[model samples]
Target chain A: MTNKAARNLFIFGSLFFFVIFLGLTVDTMNQIDGRAPEITKDVDAGKMVWQKYDCIGCHTILGNGSYFAPDMTKIVEQKPAGYLKQFLMDPRGVNPKAAMPKLGISSQEADQLLAFLTWISKVDTNGWPPKPILAAAASVAGQPQSRGQQVYQSQGCSACHSIKGIGGTSGPDLTKVGANGKDAEWHVKHLKDPHSVNPKSAMPAYGGVPEADLKELAAYLVTLK
Target chain B: MTVKYQSQKIAQYFYTFAIVLFLVQVLVGIIAAVQFINPDIFILNFNTIRTLHINALVVWLLAGLMGATYYVVPEESETEVWSLPLAKLQFWATVAAIGAVVLGYIWMGLDPQANKTVMGTQLLNEGREYIEAPRWADALIVVSVLLFLFNMFMTMLKTKKWTGIQGVLLGGLVFLALMYLPGMFYTKNMIKDQFWWWWVIHLWVEGSWEVIAGALLAFMLMKTIGAKREVLEKWMYIEVGFVLFTGILGTGHHYYFIGTPSYWKWVGGIFSSLEPVPLLLMVWDAFRTTREARNVTNKAGLFYTVAHAIFNFVGAGLWGIIHTLPQVNQWTHGTQITTAHGHLAFYGAYVLLVISMIYVTMPAIRGVTTYNQSRAYLAFWWMTISMVFIVLTITGAGMVQVYMERLMGLDYEAVKTVYNMWFWIIRAIFGVGFLIGTAIFVYDFFKIGKEPAPALAPAEQKA
Candidate 1:
């Protein structure tokens, strides 16, 4: 084909597509604007708080921002409003070594931030920033025997293995481990020398632990199922 | 040798500064990558290192583009630059502003009280991925761009001749400035904020920048290839048209998961997939012209141009499509898949375009129109191949991440621990290879000083 004719055809075709794109953008924007949530007074203030603090710098909301902090998109559903407010007011109060710097938000600002979090929690994220398996173990919540749970937490097992939907995920989900064909003896051996059970395991051995604590931790893990 | 205008020298200065910044950027990038493997080794936090790396990249690319504009406009218009003094002023101002922004990002803490005594206000880091520069620095960028646009416009106006390439370049610059304005308007409404954020990030890369790349490539093709100006210019128009057509709406791709409405799934999926069309056309035109050239003395320039087009088509087009669909994106959004696409696409399209321009212009600026054959060829292959390896390793990591995190329903922290080997071991190896290639390319660039001048007469073309 002649170059002139071909160039013209391509140009026209691209422009035709451009018009369609423009039309779609407008339609999409219209749908968004129409369905846009009403900005409540508290939500508006919370938004101002969010921007003022630059929460996005650390925490992601709806899969944006640095991944150093947890996603705040579903924070309201994950924790109580009061807990969230208190955490915002004094982050160290909730977790002594929390990386979240104290933003020195006022009590009123904390409430507003809570309201904002509540609003965001309602927004459809299409189930993003997926939750851990421990979060879904509602059946086992608060059922841990005191000694067994204490042994589990004190030994830093939670640092690598998640339970009750909160903890490190480097190890298998202990929430279902009880049903995963492992006995107390298997757990004790694995804890003493992880490489003995699985050659490729990243888990470090805890041979220094007291046999009693290891058995208690293993007993708690067995009950997770 | 062409008479060197004072303004053309400014382009060289920009190119020099930009290359320096690029080297620094790569170093900072390696540091950021290392943090993923072992966050404890680096005193500078991941946020600080990444902010510097990303901002440095944005500034260096702009510096390259500004330099290209100064060099191209003067030559194309066939006139002396409008104001050498203003160009110099703009360059220095830009450098100072960027330095301040980067320092502010590093020294300033996110906590307001810490900054209250040190700096006047609470605002320190902007925190947005690409637009991390503080308000003052962002304003400085707008001013620098306006100054650049004015200089380019006046020079073109004085010449009283406007080529199609000049028009396209100018148009892209204007849009680049305009698109940036939306990022300055921050809001608490997450969805609204995200909608405008994509306008700046996505539009510049996908939309306006494509035109700029096309015009620049067309100019290079005309010089290196003995193609008819009309043939190349005609395709420039067509390619630019396609860029605008698809690129403007391709902003929807980013909107899909940003709490925006659901319709973006279709809007983004359809239009963004077509965003690669313009690059395809440019590739076709570049190959055709190079094949038909009377003499191809600087084979590296041609290699860079062809590689730029081909890589862009694969990186921005194919890989981008891999996640553009909402169904797939729901699984891969914010994952290494996006990171993989980002690395390849940026390297392929803008980065390669700039390097190609530099290789093409360096010889012309020195009154030579040929490459330092052995060194240039080595640099070209090293960079191209190493970059491909980097893309592959990152893509492999992202794929593994998806299977472990999404399919297996693993927690984010758990997935991170499992995937540490990929980022630390595999990605780092490829990253080093990339650095080696970049070092070789930079070394070759400096070594060009003593190389023999290109023969005035056309030589038999290399295969």
Candidate 2:
């Protein structure tokens, strides 16, 4: 093969690879566009709040953002709308361990925020949060026990607590709590007002729980033992 | 002291070591492939099949790198290795490491209840638990790498000026030093453990070995094919550029689900998708140089070299692009597609290139010009054909697996049952082909230097 032939082959090959690349790029772009779930009007305002707060700057949604906050996408799916609204009203009410500062929105704004998060959860993230364990729990949203698992992972609950040989061992294990004494209703009342149960309890009250979310969350916690 | 004669002697030693280990690796590879056919084939059942795969790959590549280094260093330095005794020590240490790992696997198999230790402390132990190889084996492997590194670094330092090829060869060894980092941090957590393993596994195969392949292939072509040194050198430099360009960032692909940042998807996907660019340049350079050569000396070496170029282009370069795209990688990451890409790319491109260097240098080292080209050629063709079949089978299995596992949401067991039979059959068939190829090449190496030389010197005969 002469130099000329070699040069021609090189050029031709480059062109070929370039053409293949272009085709793949177009195909990928189309796939992304087609698969991306449309953002609904119901949650649009709430989503704007999420954006304005740069919620994703600290929190991941469907496994695509920061790790500083809970995975809000799954959280929305797992909790009731009223629970989310209450939490938005005062996250300290739900868990004092939350590092998230209260955004201090009104009842209406909090409701809108919950709607936005609910809409975000419905969007298809193409089965991200790739771990099978996490994905399974995420799929069973609104079931308290499953919701507990999501809450565990999302809120970095495992970072400070252990249950059933999983999660962080920093805090006391909660494995036998329900079996020991606390019933679902008692736990709900305690969660709504933890200091009422034990004046010296380190746990803070989750003031945001509307009645139904409180009921579901309590139901979920009851099964933990 | 004739430089060529000294180089040939070193090359002869490397040829012997390389062929022996090549056959050993092929045998281990067959066993590994068989395990995939029936995961319960081995009763010992200590380490997972993944351990077998990872260890075999590491050993095979180490042997190849040793061979390539032995052949190239003497020629580049225009001096014999400062001490053959040290070279021999390095080789034996490598052998010892391999033995230790094998024994570790066997011991773990027998004493399945032995407590698992992390960084020398008991982490977990059960009667049927997987036991990681004794830390001694890891230590020995690291020692072997260090010895090789010291020997090569010293040899290169003695050379007043470094050639472009030398730079790449040395750069590869330096990268090997970096491959040891992940093992330094032993962890009990599987997620953290796999994260670090990727550092070594992905970095070695996709990063450092690439530099070594490019350097050695170019160097061999220069000597055997009589390509212009300057042109080949320029190509080598460009090849290095391509390696670092994509390889450093391309590591993100392995981090996708390892509890790292989610942005790794975009970072790993985009950059790794471009990993083929340097490999493409390498394929181009290899072919162009071979074509430009006034005369090709060894038919077997030439064939294997060309095959290496083609496979690197298609297997490593093209097919790599197919699955490297973030979206595609998300689906195919741990599936058979990655396996197919790994086997063809690593064996065909990287391993074949090293073997090709051995083929080109064996007769030269023996001071013989022509001998048993037919056997080497036969081996090359056999391995090449088997590799193609293996790639085809795996790619088909991967596609089926992706559909079943992802699309149908079948559980892992169901997915494995669906694809395991056909995939394993193809793997076994390919294994047989590979064994035959390996045997032929090993036999040819012994026969070549022992046979009578042609009437004319090969250099004059070819030109």
Candidate 3:
């Protein structure tokens, strides 16, 4: 190509694509409120809290941040809101092994951040951050997890406790908890009120868990032996 | 060693500060890598460490580019910098900004939310990944950049002559400054925020930054290679044009999972997939130009040019296309896969270009024709090999992360802790090697031509 031709190509090509980009950007703005939930005042406040602590430095939200933490897009669905709030307030207190730092977030700010996260959870991400395939998580055991195990995961139990060398180390290892000779009744009481069995328990009460899920979780704990 | 204009010496100060920050960037990287293994151990915390690492790299690279422009523009335009004082003022302003960011991060305390007024008053971060700098810092940066740009423009304006290579550089600098403005725009919508955020981040790195890099590479090629100006200059226009044409639309890749519509899948994939075409031709162009070689004494300079071209193709182009297509990215979004691509592409495209500028420009600034390039060669090979290892290890970590966490239903924490720890250790080990190579390069840069020139003193003095 001649020099002038190359120059024309440069100017024209850039302008052409940039204009298209601008068009798509406008279209995206139009489609956004349709694709994702509307931003509430609480959600706006939540985004402020998200930025205040520099969460994206360690956490990926919308799959766009660093990989220091898990993706926050579907976190509201994966984790209980209460658990998330507490985790945000006191990361190590909630899960002693958590890599996150306590950003000194207040209860109000935690609520805002959670709201933002919830709003994010509803955003249509084009099927991104695909669900973890069961086969890979259970690949080591070569067996699908039991239903109670599913309940444990769904209930965010692993945020504080461990099972068979997996999960957090904040709470007792339930790998051999059945050997403790605790029956389901006692386990249920511990779930509802950890201080009932152990006066020094730092674990928060999981009383709000649905009674059925609580019962299933207690049943699963005794089977750890 | 023949100094064209006194203004070229102004670049030395910028390079000095930039090299220092580059060192800090490497040190912070080592710390971050170690923290990856055991997070609770560091007082800095992963957040602080990560912010520093990224922020330092960004500043150092920008400083390097700014310095490089000061060095190259005057010669290309056949005039002195229009305002040497402004160039020096920019250097000082940048240094202060770096200090404020580093100190504010370290001593600003962990509870920035509680100290909201303090953070805002002090002009600290708002926590976007590449753009954590607070609005105030952003403004300060904009002002300084404008001052720097104004100086460059005036210098170019002094001589009403334009080279294709210089024009690209000037255009890239203006684009660089303009792109920063988008990041300043705030939106209540998370998707909208990210969409605009990528405009600043992706557009700068993939679009404007690439143009600047192409111009720098062209400048070096012209200096060290026997290729005709028109041939190299034409290649410049083509590559830069393709960069923007494909790159502007290619930003849809970031848009795909950020709450944008599904049309981005096709728009992003097609455009981004075609990005490698220009890059591949760039690699071929570098080869074609190099084959028509002159008796180039500046071997290190040539090495960096060719290497930048090849790696720009491999790192940014090849690795990028690997996941740019939506099907593959479906599994890899936000995974370590992105990390692998980011490191390789940044180091290859920008970092190498910066180092090459120092290699090619510094010797003349220091008036050293007898440059002992043996140490430079050592540093180059060491860093190059170490970078390959670093990238491989990270890529290994990324693969395992994709397979275990995304593919498998493993807990995210378990995938990071149980699976990726070993790779992190390997990456940190090679991180040390990369640091050593950088140190050698910096040290060698100072000692480049301490040896006296050959005995042609009569002709030199007579002139």
Best by DockQ: 3
Q: List RMSD in Å for every model shown.
A: 8.1, 14.9, 3.3
Docking class of 3: medium
> For candidate 1, lDDT tens digit of each residue in B1-463?
3336646867878988888888888887787677667654576666667777777888889899889899989888988899999999999998888777766776654434333311322355665678867666778889999999999999999977877778778888998899899898657566777777887898889977887998898888876665687888888877887787777777777877776676777878888888877778888887888778765766677778788888878888888888888778887877677778888898888888888888777776766545556777776677778778878877887787677655654455555655546655666676677777778877876766467755545345341
Q: For all candidates listed, what's the TM-score of chain B alone? A: 0.94, 0.90, 0.95
Query: Predictions ranked by TM-score, top down?
Result: 3, 1, 2
Worst 10 residues of 1 chain B by lDDT: B113-122
Candidate 3 error regions (>4 Å): A134-162, A165-173, A192-195, A198-220, B109-122, B452-463
Evaluate model 3 with DockQ and give the value. 0.65
Q: Identify the leading candidate in terms of TM-score.
A: 3
Give a tens-digit lDDT track for model 1, residues A1-225.
455664565457656765776676566556654444666989977876675565765566777776545567776765445546666877656544344556688899898888888887776654555543443454258565568788876675655467765565434567888998899999999989977997655456788999998998888788887
User: Candidate 1: misplaced stretches above 4 Å?
Assistant: A1-59, A67-70, A79-115, A126-225, B3-6, B109-122, B450-463
Indicate whether candidate 1 or candidate 2 has the larger DockQ: 1
Which lDDT value does model 3 have at A137?
A: 43
Models ranked on lDDT: 3, 1, 2
Judging by TM-score, tell me the better candidate of 1 and 2. Answer: 1
